[model samples]
Target: MDGSFENAAGQARARVALRWRRIGFSALVLGSCAALLGLMAATLFVEAPDPVGIAMLLLFALTLPWTTIGFWNAVIGFSLMTFCRDPAGLVAPHLRSIGGTEKIASSTALLICIRNEDTGRLQRNLGWMLEGLVASGESRWFHLYMLSDSNQAPIIEDEQRVAAELSARFGSALSITYRRREESSGFKAGNIRDFCERWGSLHQFAIVLDADSVMTPAAMLRLVRIMQVQPHIGILQTLVTGLPSASPFARIFQFGMRLGMRSYTLGAASWQGDCGPYWGHNAILRIAPFTEHCHLPVLPGKPPLGGHVLSHDQLEAVLMRRAGYEVRVLPEENGSWEENPPSLPEFIRRDLRWCQGNMQYFHFLSLPRLLPVSRCQLGLAIAMYLGAPAWLGLMTLGLLRQMPIRADLGALLFILTMVMSFAPKFATLADVLARSPLRQAYGGTARILVSAFLEMLFSMLIAPISAVAVTLFMLGLPFGREMGWSTQQRDAEGIPFALAARRLWLQTVLGFVFAVCFWRVVPGAVWLWAPFVLGLAGAIPLAMASADPRVGRALAAVGLCRIPEEARLPAEPEYATLFAPCAPLSPTGATE
Candidate 1:
């Protein structure tokens, strides 16, 4: 009785502490956003604010919360990375209690959800993971389920052959199951649901993986052990980094992503605590709670924004939280990876799908019994896509309004905004450069700096292009324009010039129009909008060049934008073939 009372008291105290952390984090984010918005208001209304100026301020205001939250996350993350002994442990104390020798008593289902995908690549990723797990002697505690929704006969046959090969290779060392659905009713979520209904009872936990996801056995063991020890956690998401890619577009894009994600995730996890994000894949879920309470609701419509939830991860997280379970992210970049889109066109296609799915979150904002943070998360997801249109609106309005302003203050504000916008990447970059080990891991200071500079340029070019695409997609969401769930092109194939031109014609035309208008109306300040204009104007060529095989080869040859995985051989011999194409070239032009 006394021990129970002490335990209850400890829980109470922890709850109070968490509440305070949430309050403090909220105060910081809201306060920072308010201050920035005030500055923008002052800048816009220096003279009496007209309707256009007011509209610009409103749009600018809309863009702030996301940027401010990200900026603060980066700042806090950088501080932790620089100052703390164990930054991830500080955020997730449960992780500190995990000793590597812990027994994996809990049964975990490794669910690899796939659509029509490249089975060869899938086979390699799955085989390595299974081999690692088997070697760890924890194969008995885990099961592999290849849940496929492949409609193509060829791909389906390939998936079967791959599954057969893996089964034959592993023999009885690991349990492997392959299931395919004739109709992908709920898309990926439905596929998962079918698994839950059929075999979820067999496992205590599920580590969800996309077709492109690959996790080392050690990482899988860590997640399993953490879940085994901490039964209260519903979801534990790993910080999945991009795999080394030979594609120039993917390399540069993921390099920027790698820089930003570390700080952003760490900082967000610090405050988000139990209300952390679950990014669909590369995460472990408590099967019981996830199956019992986290079933997705079909929205009241058809396709796109309606029917089955496309962005099912967050909603599942919310539901799990509502069921009184902690949803968390392990912010350390361990041996977990996923392939990014190989080119600009594929990237846009993926981004639009997310945009469409995020827009569906509007229906859940008013959900009952949800924690405030959960609602805020849903709102932020919506705002993420909404900010694209808001940014475009601000630019369009700025061009049209051409309001008289003090150049120095305006420029200062613009600089501040840009700094905050890129703070996550900058924060992680600073951390990387500050540590000698990190610099060496990334192939030294000179290479890191060069890669970062080039990546910055790539980011600037891609941002406006993505924004325009998202804005256009968002505009069509209300009119029944659906980005259907389809097989993603994962290969780093060169995009044809005609294909690029066809896809980005609107962006190019809009860029030309903006340039003409900026020159005619505000020629003196045309440089102010150069980044956005040039990105739009050169959208087609940029897409083609970024996706060009020669460009990728050139970048690879020079060791530019190389990730750590590319600099050295993977610890596991099985990954050698996978990383060979991404490996740095020797002085003699051979792969080092």
Candidate 2:
């Protein structure tokens, strides 16, 4: 047995080393492609005179600068040592160690309010985080509260079971509370309102957590300290690091996110300062400020047109700012983590809700309180991300028309945009390497390089899937069903037939449209459409990954499918010394 175990370990190490070598080689190949593309674009720009040529030239120019950025971000986006080079390094850690900060023990109750959530999965997430906190020596300083909205049969039982279990173990140190609701009057916001009115005065602050949210031990501490020192900060939300289950598509995505969009979020917040976008959950709030000043106003109207703010996060931030408290994002910690929709269908469903909320932003842009310079920065952030679809739309429409549009600067901007999009991932990866003991596990250098290439390939394929998904959701809004406060379903790769069909069909139509235009129009534009294509191709695999990866039956092993340039990729080690708190809760059957 000893001989066999040693042999296995030896094999793993060999594989990891080979993997890094592959990574280096892949990086060289990609770097060469980007450099050559940059040269081509630069040379073309100097010779353009015709309108069509100029437009293409401009487009190329816009793209090249970002190519450099995207390439660099890909290189270092996941830095291991910086405690997350993306956004957490910016604020969470800073607040954690700040001297004047006071610990608000029991004074603040961090609530993990839920509706129809799987108690087993909830316990797992809650367990991991709280354990990390206790191991880090913060068990006594905080209290955990859970609010449930399960009114139905099986769900209510599971929820009660979960609540009772948690209440039993940490009865005094931890508290689990559940509520079905007096009525569905205001939806989720109302459920929370009742909590505040009932127990609001007992605690100075209440950290609101969604069912899917997971926080690092330190992330929770920083939130409390920040609330303590910055008395006027009504909400200091962080840019979340979303982790999905497992599979080629899921792993690639969960990891790639920090690489791509996360940096932009970090940069946007850093550059803009006080005007960060509100992500709703995974944030801290003062009870007095929220209840007395931040209560949401009902917009006078009916279905889809009006009701309590569906996008309450944005409204909360705007209201907080209006009430003289600063609403900001602290990147210093990676305390709060959440789940990303593993597949395109779920992603679009989630986005539909956002679009409806954002559509309202267009209306509120003129509201002085809603769009004050600090708050207006929030709107501007919305437009910056939203511009992606519009920009893609332009590329599509322009090609279909065969109209001569200038692409000179536009091309450069778009290229730089891609770089900005991907570079953060590289930086984030580097950070990850610096921290994980899996340094040996992830392979030496070759594997990282190969993984990067495969990662990029997968990213491109998903692009079209996402673009069309976004477009479809936007179009479907007018006739869409009234989405409610739904719980995230957890199962081992269980995607119902109806949901799968709806997604596949929509993707097929969108891909065909883009493909036709790509063939008929300027062939160059198809590169920009990489987003949609990559996504559609990877849809099936992503769907499979969303189910619990631990369940073991993988549709396709993400590591095996790509990155053969390396031998073996690394896996995260269980750092037991780091987490010993959050002993499993006994759970209760009684409702609070």
Q: Which residue window of length 10 is worst by lDDT in model 1?
A: 566-575
lDDT per residue for candidate 2 within 431-516, as digits (tens), equals 54564443433443555556666677766666556656555555655674455455554333556556666667666555566666
Candidate 1 ranges beyond 4 A from true positions: 1-8, 570-574, 586-592
**lDDT of each structure?**
0.88, 0.57
Itemize residue pairs with steric clashes in candidate 1: none
Clashes per candidate, residues 3 or more apart or on different chains: 0, 99
Runs in model 2 deviating more than 4 A are: 1-106, 128-141, 381-389, 404-414, 426-444, 478-482, 492-499, 523-592
lDDT of 1 by residue, 1-592 (tens): 9999998998898778888877888899889888877777777777887999889888988898889899989999999999999998988887786888988898899999999998989998998899889999989988899999999999999999998999999999888999999988988899999999999999999999999999989999999999988889999999999987767898888889889999999899887889999998999999988988999999998877888888888899999999999998988888899998989999999999988888999999999999999999999999998898999999888878857766667777888888998999999999999998788777788888999999987888779999999998888888899887898998888888889988999999999998898888777876578888899999998998888766776787776777777645755456786677676567775666
Q: What is the TM-score of candidate 2?
A: 0.72
State the displacement of the C-alpha of residue 262, model 1, in Å, after optimal TM-score superposition. Answer: 1.3
